[model samples]
Target chain A: MSTPVLELARVTVEFPTDRGRLRPVDGVSFSVEAGKTLAVVGESGCGKSVTALAIMGLLPQGGEVGGGIRLAGEELLALTPDQRRARRGGEMAMVFQEPMTSLNPAFTAGEQVAEALRLHQGLSPDAAFAKAIEMFRRVRIPEPERRARSYPHQLSGGMRQRVMIAMALACRPRLLIADEPTTALDVTVQAQILALIDEMKRETGTAVVLITHDLGVVRDHADEVVVMYAGRIAERAKAADLFANPQHPYTIGLLGAVPRLEGGAARLASIEGTVPDLMNPPPGCRFAPRCPFAIAQCAEQPPLAEVTPGHQAACWRAPLDTLLEQAA
Target chain B: MSAPLLELRDVAKGFPVRDALGRRRGAVRAVDGVSLIVPKGSVLAIVGESGCGKSTLGRLALRLIEADQGQILFEGEDLRGLSARALRARRRDMQLIFQDPFASLDPRMTVEQAVAEPLRLHGIVPRAQEAQRVAELLSRVGLRPELARRWPHEFSGGQRQRIAIARALASEPKLIIGDEPVSALDVSVQAQVVNLLQDLIRELGLTFVLISHDLGVVRHIADRVAVMYLGRIVEEGPTAQVFGAPRHPYTRALLAAVPGQGHAHAPLLEGDIPSPINPPSGCRFRTRCPYAQPLCAEQVPPMEGTSHLAACHFQQNLPPALVGQDAETGGERLRRLQAYFTDQTQKQGELA
Candidate 1:
């Protein structure tokens, strides 16, 4: 589809733990087209955020990136450290869950936005300042002139998040990676932020990689869904298709566990097991330990195969048609 | 037909808020003019955003913090008259389960010690019986009884929460008030905990007061739901009615806000929530109210109805046929709202 804006072709992110080099993101491959949102949903420690960090080239020390990372037909892995730094804000940006930490307390929100622009674009001092104010306006910050001088401590949680978004969008990056952007926000504020992000994507046509643990957020805003479990893509499909028919046992368990809005006062279908540790995941299928319908074949790692035209699920016993039927 | 288990009549609580100068300039009206009843063996969920005072209302109901005004009656007993010792006795019947399991537990104490502390405090059982009671409590919450010797740190988030539940049940409380019990937990973990609570409710016939922001959780556990705004209940009803067909504009807006509801987003509630210390002149929601008329601005909507309640100037079910209309508009309006917001911001940005 016109060369995906971003692609992780069999990417693997590894870390040096006490035991040895452990792969947190194992042989994962996915892509996002410009103007579309690809949601990665999973429980904690499912390598959701780690995958996002890996894309942004912001991995901490002692961690290594293995495999392909392409951005708009260009190999990001081949880029020099300076080239990667230059590419970051001007072409790609991120907004973390907690804005309080993501933002610099020493600087005003406007300064932070201006700094992002100045570093990547080399804008003049006056021009950078002006752009910062303009970016704040784009994020719907009330009284941009006044807020430009106010420190991070002065803003509310919602406003602080707006500033973070402004910083991420200042240079109009081709890709915006939001990691649990609204996790700390209230429901109403969350609605506003999601609406804002959706609007920005349509206007800028910037591809978005949304990483979150909330299924509702995925349902509301995402164009495509990539369900991950223990460092691998367990299921991948269009958002509409995934909701209509989740073929993976993990996906089914996640949907059933949540209290549905439309259903009659039915019992919540809870998944039975805990999320596995990525450091020492199961030998075969990482999810087989938790799968209710795990068969003898599950002991052999099942490759993520297309269960439908565009829907892929990595499960040995999940009847593709049955899950689709129940969802309908 | 019997009297409700717990009732709060015109309850209010105000906490002194200090200004930047360290002077107590005003009091934040956390919970104001709230009234509701919890039926015997039924669950009542109080739902709202932060600063709506739902959590404070819960704590106030238990007299963990005394209400500045209004009456809290527990099965016809006035909470105000109870002596410290008598209140301690009543604590055995009404227990609170906090939202953060890690924060609530003692890191040094083993699970066995934590569970047994309540038993020792209430003097519910003798020394020998304490061990047996601890094991039973552990098993009741779906934990292996032998793992009680492990410290809270050894358990996962879900397991720690289960331990907390086991400790709460040590007193065999007739009423359990869970304050955002599962908000901090994993969704799968949340489901298991919710299921365990439901099972406990059915088996013990214990009344419950659940305070949560997640509407789905409320819908699952609550027999009745109360919608709160700026410390007051704007709507109350049976779970099905409240969810299936919310009457108030606010309730309708909330139902629309939930993703996957297939509702058109209407400019995602404008402006930040106003300070509770200075609520709007009339309706607290009127500041951000889309349908606010001159009447809404001048007068406070009466919180009305018996079996089901809604506070609004024009509130006769909003032309009943209009129900489920939101489900039809779905993503189109959401897309439009997103575009509008983005464009509007762009203009605002250009202006600056």
Candidate 2:
């Protein structure tokens, strides 16, 4: 089998707080094969964003990262700050959630994208400018030349996001990490952006690490899925398998919580309690406090075990019906 | 049929756009000639993207913002005809829950005080019973009474929303309007709030107006839905009908645009929604609409249908693919997903 384009093994990110070190992302491991999308799904503080930032070496101050991040079999953690800077936008790129904030207010969209091209690819001024326009047109921006000259404020949210994507993909990196790419856009615009990303990935065969909280998007867009809870992987599987046969109580609760478009008038089964505080996370399963199928053995950490072929879950009573029947 | 609990007739509101020099630069029609009826004890969701006027319409219903034109009738009484005092008194029967609980709630005030202020203002309960009423309202929204003494900032997002809902329910309102109430919350927390709102509406027999951009949440809680575009409701109907077989091209596009619908590849409308200041002369959606024709540009299409109204000329002639009745049911997918949980549990039981 061909090696994965991007691989993360036992990645852990800890931030020092007043009380102690708060481990936001604890021992997460996943891989994105070339041309395939791997989505890390979770709610706020689940360490999905932190993991993305850690991979990019953009963790905030006081953050300590441990474990391995390999880009095309190259150890990313071994690279110095200068080397990491060179790798960003050349070998890998990231698209942030908020386009308005991510973009520079003073510079025109064209200038910004051109700057990325020139910095990463060492293209001449005119060549970089022309390439920026081409990237804009490729992203389906109407009136590419005119839009390129327009500042970020002059463009709409969707247009700005297109510019961001154009900038991220200017150098044609082997890997693309989009963190909530469409969260700020409208539904119609979101569809367009998602399609654009997918099209880009297909054309370039870039391995994509899509980080989002929306399960619906993950179901449609991702080839593989990793469900995160309280800085830990709750479940990981192929998209179809995970959606078709979610095993973890947290995963089940998440699926049950989302209101299906066709499911008529059924009360959603909400997962009780908030996410565990990462600074003082639970010892066993991070989700044990809220897991309906939690047992005494859950007090001790449960290793992520295969529930079905290619589907893994970290829960003591996964395939919860057997536990229920025994209890009955 | 009995009179609608709330009715909006050709309601229109426009705010003047001013230049840097304070000169008027045309008007931006936030809500333009929108008409709808909310039956008693029904959950009516106004779904749309930002700048679609759903929030504006909700504010108009409560007279929080005055409508420049048209009639707003609540309980068969025109809100415009009511005197200031009468309006103030009537406000006790109608309440609003905002999207940002922290912003809506006063930081200095405790949850108890925030909830009790409504009761005290409406005189719904005597001064002595105000505390008890606040406790009841808090419990109704699934909040602990003990937490009422805590300030809004001390609470979590979901808890803050519960406090907001408690405040909304304090006056024993007959009608409640929530403007993107759960949009800011986490999925798990959002579900809890959605369930709480559904239960509250059913148990209290309150008329609900939910303004949201989320179609998933709308499908869960709403009985009827109005799909707003630009500043008008292009389609309005029962939730099932609107979702299952969207007639208007825009509605179809909106539904198809939903993630996991398998229609992501199919391009919907193109370009951003046109600016409201200079909306398209005829159909506001015509500029971006793929089915737009010369007639669509020349004349506005009148809304058609008895219960499910759609403001589009080509709605009747739309292709089957646009109207998604033949598409795979999301319920089937959900069932398949749910079966995984059940199947796993069963397999585990056998092992045990």
Candidate 3:
């Protein structure tokens, strides 16, 4: 089997606060195999975005790495700032949530894309322009040549996203990290964008780390699913198995909460309580406060245990297959 | 029922477009030849993509923007018959909830002031009783009455929307038009707001005309659904019929693209929504319609229906999707969505 493209082993991101070194991500581990996809899904401030930002080495100021962040066999944590800068857009690239702000206003769509190629590959200006235009074609940007000179404002919301994808793919990174990429896009455009990424991954065999709160999007795009709550992995499994049988209460709650388009009478089962304050995380399973199936043992931090091969859930009732079946 | 509290008869709106040569070019038809019957105390959702005349039709219904052609009837009275002052007086019964809560709310005004402003302006209640009325409205929409004292900046996106809703409810209107109300909110938050709106519809017995880009929200809130394409309603039917078993190809495509719509796709359209200024001949959706035939391009498809309506000529020819029958399979359908998306992904690769 091919080596994993990106791996986070016991990765935790910490910050120095007035109280103490508050850990935002605590001992979380996940990997993205080549040509595969892993989704980190949870509500806001659940450490989904933080985990992605940590992987990208784009953590906001005052953040410190407390564990291993490896990309293509290299220890990213050990790399200097300049070296990491070299790593970004060369081996690993990030596609952000908001394309409007991520893209520059002054630059034409082509110029912005070509800038990536030129900066990374040191291609001649003409060569870079040609390559950027080709990338645009690959992403299915209409009238690639004509759209090349157009500014971000000139293109529609979906078209702007295509441009962002073009820029991300321009470098042909080994690992692509998309943080809520389609959250802002309309449904049709989201389908197209997801398809674009899926196509790119198949063609290039690039490993992708998708971070989003949307369960359906994760189901649609991911090969593996990582359910994150309160800066910890609640459950991790293949997308099919995860959806077929969600183990964690948080995962179950999330699945049950989503309103289906078919219009059922089933009441959305909201997981009780908001995500705990990251400033002072709970001692036990962070989801214990919200978990209906939580036990006294869960008051002590539950270890991420393998309930099944290729599937792990950090729950005392991890093997509640029968209960899950009943709930579904 | 209730004589269709609000109605639009042959309503259309167009704005003058100027060319580079500084001459007045052809008018941009924003909403064209649209008609709707918004029954009292029920929710009617207008679902469509951008430039689909949904918003314009929504505005035309309330006369927020005047229709260049056709009639707007409020409780069997023609809106145009009334003088400006009389129209303003009638407007107390119809209020609009805009798409963006951030932009809709007055920045300078406190939530209390914003909500009570309507009460004061319309003199719905005694001037001294405005504060109590505002608080009651706030709490009704699931907001804390004390929140009224704070500014919009102090609240989250959902909270701001609640304040907006509170303000909309201030007039005690019979019919409320929510233009993409929950499209801007988070899923969990959206569900809360959607539920709140549903509760409002039931409790207040206020008629709702919802214009939204999110069909899921429509599926939940609307009694009847209207699907628009290029300034025209391509399909309109009972929410169940339109969503469970969508007839039109365009409607099917829209459903297929919806996140949990049981049917997923490789996005049937290759290009953007066409310029309404130069809409395609025949079926407006023909340019991007996946199942468009030569006949579709030759002659315009009339918006036809027996009891419910659709404008697609090949409605019967298209493959069946759950339009009205979807409610029974809601959970099962979402569970199966992963398979559908994977299938589309495969098709995309194969097509590519």
Candidate 4:
């Protein structure tokens, strides 16, 4: 079998606080092949963003990372800071949630994208600027030549995101990590930006790690999904199988929580209680406290095990059908 | 039907735009000549993207911001004509819930104090019974009474929003306007809040005006929906009718833009929402409307239809909304999986 474009093996990220350590991302493992999209789904503080940051070697100050992050069989943690920086824009690129914040307000949109090209590909100043305009055109920004001169604040939210995408893909990196790329924009503009990313992925065969809290976006865009709860992987499977036969209790509760546009029950199914604080996580399964099907055996953490052929869940009573049948 | 609990007739509001040097450039017409009626004990959701005036309309309805033009009638009385003192008295009947719970709440105040402030202001309860009243209010929104002593900063996002809701309900309001109340919450917590709001609306027979951009939430909670673009409402109708058979091209495009509604490749709208400072000549949506014709630019289209209305010249001849197959979400198995969730909740209820 061909090697995957990117693979994470039991990644852990911790930050030392005055009150002991806080592990935001704990033992997360997943992979994405060339041209496939892997969606990391979670709520606020679930460490989905931290995982992305860890992979990019962009963790905030005081953060300590452990475990393997491989890009095309190249071990990333073993690389020096300068070597990592060299490979960042050339081999892997990340697009942030808010373009207004991520982009430099002082630079014109065109210059911002062109700077990446010159730094990564060693293109001439004039050639890089010309290619930046071409990249803008490829992303379907209208009147690319004129619009390129506009600063970040001068462009609309959708247009600013287009510029960000153009910059991220200008290097044609093997891996693209977009952290909630469209959450700040309106839904209509979100559609346009998502389509642009999908199109670019197909054209470049870039492996995508899309981190979002919106299930609808995942349902439509993701090839595979990793459902995270309290910094731990709760479930992982092909998107179709995950949606159809969600094994973990958290995944089921999350799927039932989203208000379906197609219309369903009047009242949404809610999982009781808030997400557990990760500062002092539970001794056993991270989701046990909130899991309705939790048993005494759940006091010992369950390893991520196969529930079906390619589907894995970290619940003691996974293959919940058997659990339910036993209960009945 | 009886008279509407709240009504707006040709309401319009504009904010003056200023350049960096502070010179008056032009006014951004936020809400332009919008008219609607909210019947007693019903949910009317105004859905649109940012800059679409849904939030501005909600503020106008509550008199939080004054409209430059038009009449706002509350229970057959015009609010625009009310005196300052009279408006304060009327304020007890209406309340506003903002989108961000963290920003909306006061960190310094305890939950009990925040919830009881409205009661004290409105003279709903005597000073002696204020604590008891606050406790009851907290429990009504599904918060524990003991948590009342805790500060707002101590609560989670969802908990803070419940405290906000409890405060909103303290004065026993008849009409509530929630501007993207659940938008900032996580999916699971959002569901909990949505269900809580649903129960509150039903049990209290409250009239609700939900201003949100989330179509799925609107479809679940609203009896009727209004789709806005630029500064004007482009479509208004029963939620089922509008979602099932949208007439306006803009509304169709908005529905199609939902993530799971159609294939990702088939994008509907093109350019961003045009600047509200100098909107299009006639129809505000014409710039992005796929089926826009010369007539659309020539004259503004008046809203047509009795119960269901669409403000478009070609609304009648527009093609049906092409939302993709319902089976893409893995329909049958998903339903079966969700059924187990419902069963588990019921079992929990029984055990309790």
Candidate 5:
């Protein structure tokens, strides 16, 4: 197998809160192969975004990142600040959820994309501007030149997101991290943006780390799925396998909780209780408190073990059918 | 048989667009020529994207915002004709639950005081009995009565929503309009609240108007559904029929766009929704409609259906299956999920 474009090993991120250090992302491990999408799925504060930030070495002040992040077998954690900044756009780039906030309101859309090109590729201002227009056109931005000159406020949400994508892909980075890229846009617009990302990946062969809470989005787009609960991976498997045979209780609960567009009305199988507090996380499995299948053994930490080939879950009661039959 | 619990006749609402200088530039038709019926004790969901005027229509039903040209009838009485005092008294029968429970609730007030305020104002219960009624309302919505003394800030999003629901029920309203009530909650918590609402609607025999962009939630709770586009309902029908066989191109597109259905990348509609201030001349959806033609841009399509209504010129000409044949039929996944839920419940029962 080819070397993964981006890899993480035991990535743990800790933040110093007033009470104590909160480990929001703990011992996370995953790799994104070039041209394929690895969806990190979780609810808010599930460390999906924090994992992305840690990989990019963009963790906010007071956040301690411990673990290895590698870009094409090169150690990212060992790089100097300058070296990291240089590699950021050229090797990797991130598209955030809120295009409005991430983008500079003072600058025009063209200037932003051009700035990325200039800083990363060492292109002249005029050359970068031309490249920006080209990138915009490639991303299917209608009236590319005119739209490029428009400021962030002038462009609609979808168009601004396209601009963000254009900027992220301008340098042809091998890795692209999109954190809820289409969340703020409407469904129609969301469809367009997701399609655009998929197209860009196909054309560029860029590894994508799509961080989103919506399982439906993961089902449609991701090659591999990582289900996170309270900063730990609850389950990991191929997208189809995960959907067809979710092993973890949290994953099953999540699937049942989602109201399907095609499904008839039924009482949603809601997971009881909320996400555990990461500040003072419960012992053993983070999901045990909320898991209906939990037993006394669940109080002891369960290793993430393979249930089937390429399918893994972190639960003592994995392969729940067996457990259910025993109980029955 | 009986008159609809609430009805709107040719309802239209327009807000004047003003420049920075405060001069009226033009009028934006937020809700234009919308007419709907809510049968007693039925859940009617208004589904649409942002700026489609679903929220505006919800407010119009409650007469929170007056419609310029329409008649809003509550219990078969025209609300516009009612005096201010009469309207205030009539308000006791209808209540609203907003999207952001945190924002809708008073931060300084305890849950008890918040719930009792409506009872005190409406004189639903005697002053001495307000506390008991508040506790009942709280417990009815799945909150512990002991937590009624806590402020809104102390509760979680779902709990805050429960408090809001409790307050809504405090007035003993016959009808409740929830504008994206559970949209702010996590999926697990959202389901709990949805089940609660469904239970309340069934047990209390209350009518509900749920305004949400989430099709899944709407499908779960709504008996009837209305699909709104730029300020107009493009489709309205029983949930089963509309979702099973979506006739309107926009409706089909919206359903197709949903993620979990294993739909291949099929762009049903393209381009952003046009500005409401200067809407397209004919069919509002024509600009983005795939089947739109010269005729579509020239004339408006009148809604036509006996039981399942759709306002589109090419509704009949549309393919019987806009989505692929392999797409799972509505209700199959839910049935399986329901079975799963039941099995899990039994397991938990055994464990307990």
Candidate 6:
């Protein structure tokens, strides 16, 4: 098999507070194949975004990332600050959730894309600006040249997201990290943006790590799925397999919580408690407190072992079908 | 079915656009020539994207924002005819729940103070019984009565929403309009709140107006659904009919655009919703409608049908809605597993 485009080994991120060190992302590991999409799914504060920042080396002040992040077999964490900066827009790029905040209000949309191109591709301003307009056109922004000259405020949410995509893909980055790219946009616009990303992935063979809380979005777009709970990976598997047969209690709970359009008027099955506090996380399995299948053995941490071929879950009571049958 | 609890007859509202110099430029027809009927004890959901005027319509329904033109009839009485005193008195029956619980709640007030305020104002119970009533309201929304003394800032998003719901119920309102009530919470928490709302609606038999963009939530809760676009309802029907077989192109597109409904990558509609200030001349949805004809660009399509209404030039001849392939995620077993997650009794029973 061909080598994966991106791999993470024991990825851990820690932030120091006055009392103690807060480990939000702990010992996370995953791999994304070239041209395929891997979705990191979790609620807010689940370390999904933190994991992305760890990979991009963009952690905020006093936040330390410990782990090996390999992009195309090259270690990103080992690179010098300057070297990492050089590779950022050229080999790896990210599209943020809110384009309005990420984009500069002073710079025109076209100029932003052009700036990335000039910085990464070393093209002249005029040439880069022209390419920027072309990129705008490629991303299906109507009236590309005119829209390119408009500031971020002038463009709508969908249009601004398209501009962000144009900027991110301007240098043809091999790894594209989109963090809730469509959360701010309307559903119709979201569909358009996701479709554009899929097209770009197929055309450029870029490895995509889509970070989202929306399961429907993951079901449609992600090839592989990683379910995170309180900054730890609870389950990882093929998207179809995970959805069809979720092994972790958190995964099943999350799936059951969503109000499906087809599941007419059925009472939604809700998880009882809130996400655990990361700073003072519970011992053993992070989800044990909330897991219905939890037993006395759950006090001991469960390893993320293979429940099936290519499917892993961090639960002592994995393969819960047998338990159900025994109870019956 | 039942008599309408609230009705609007050709209601319209416009906010005047002003320049930096305070000179009026034009008007944004936010809710233009719209009409709706909310039956007593029924959930009427208005689903639309942002800037589509669903929020404005909800506000107009409660007279939170006055409509520029048309009659707002509440309980068969013209709300627009009421004087200031009468309106204030009538306000006890109608309440609004906003999307952002963080903003909707008073940061300085304790949960007890917030919930008790409405009871005091309405004189529902004596001052002596206000605490007891507040406790009841808190427990009604699934929050612990002991937490009433805490400030809004101390609670989580879902808890804050529960407090908000408790406050809204304090007045014993006959009609409650929830504007994206659970949109701000995580899915797990959203479901809890959704279930809470379902239980309240059933137990109280209160009329509900759910204004949301989340189709799944709307479908699950609302008996009747109204699809709005550019300040007008393009489709209105029973939830089953609208989801099963939508008549309008925009409605179909909206349904198709939902992420988990199987259709991905292929966008059913194109382009952004046009600026409402200077809307397209004829049909408001013609700009993005897939089945839009030349006639649609020339004349506005009048809403047709009695039960399942749709405003389209050729609703009868439009192609069938794209059938979504069910992304089968084991149904019966999935439910049982989910049941175990929420119900501890189920787990204990299994163990026994």
Q: Score every model by TM-score.
A: 0.93, 0.95, 0.88, 0.97, 0.96, 0.98
Recovered native contacts, candidate 6: 0.65
- Give the CAPRI class of candidate 6: medium
Docking class of 5: medium
On DockQ, the leading prediction is 6
Relative to the unseen true structure, what is the C-alpha lDDT of residue A189 in candidate 4, on a scale of 0 to 100?
Answer: 91
Please provide, for model 5 over A113-180, each residue's C-alpha lDDT reduced to its tens digit, 9 standing for 90 to 100: 99999898899999999999999999899999999899999998999999999999999999999999
Q: Can you write out model 6's per-residue Cα lDDT over B172-276, one digit (the tens) per residue? A: 999999999999999988988998899899999999999999998988899999999999989999988988888988888888888965544245579899999
lDDT of 5 at B127: 88
TM-score of chain B of each: 0.89, 0.92, 0.88, 0.95, 0.93, 0.95
Could you give the CAPRI-style class of model 2?
Answer: acceptable
Give a tens-digit lDDT track for model 2, residues B86-183.
Answer: 99999999999999977999999999999999888888889998888888888787777888788998888988898899898888888999999999
Candidate 2's TM-score reads: 0.95
Per-residue lDDT tens digits for candidate 1, residues A174-200, read 999999999898888888898889988
i-RMS values of the candidates, in order? 13.6, 5.6, 10.0, 2.6, 4.1, 3.1
Model 4 Cα lDDT, one tens digit per residue, B1-352: 6679999999999999999999999999999999999999999999999999999999999888999999999998999999999999999999999999999988889898899999999899999999999988888888889898899889899999999999999999999999999999999899989988998999999999999999999999999999998889889999988888888888787878888643643555898998889999988888898888899898999999999999999877876567522335545555565666566666655111
Comparison by TM-score, 1 against 5, better one: 5
- Cα displacement (Å) at residue B297, model 5: 1.5
Prediction-by-prediction clash tally = 0, 5, 8, 0, 0, 0
- lDDT string for model 3 (B30-138, tens) is 9989888888878888888877888888888888788898999999999977899999999899999987899998889999999999898898999888888988888
Every model's DockQ = 0.25, 0.48, 0.23, 0.59, 0.54, 0.60
Candidate 3 TM-score, true structure as reference: 0.88
lDDT of model 5 at position A60: 95
How does each model score on lDDT?
Answer: 0.83, 0.87, 0.81, 0.89, 0.87, 0.90
The residue pairs found clashing in candidate 5 are none
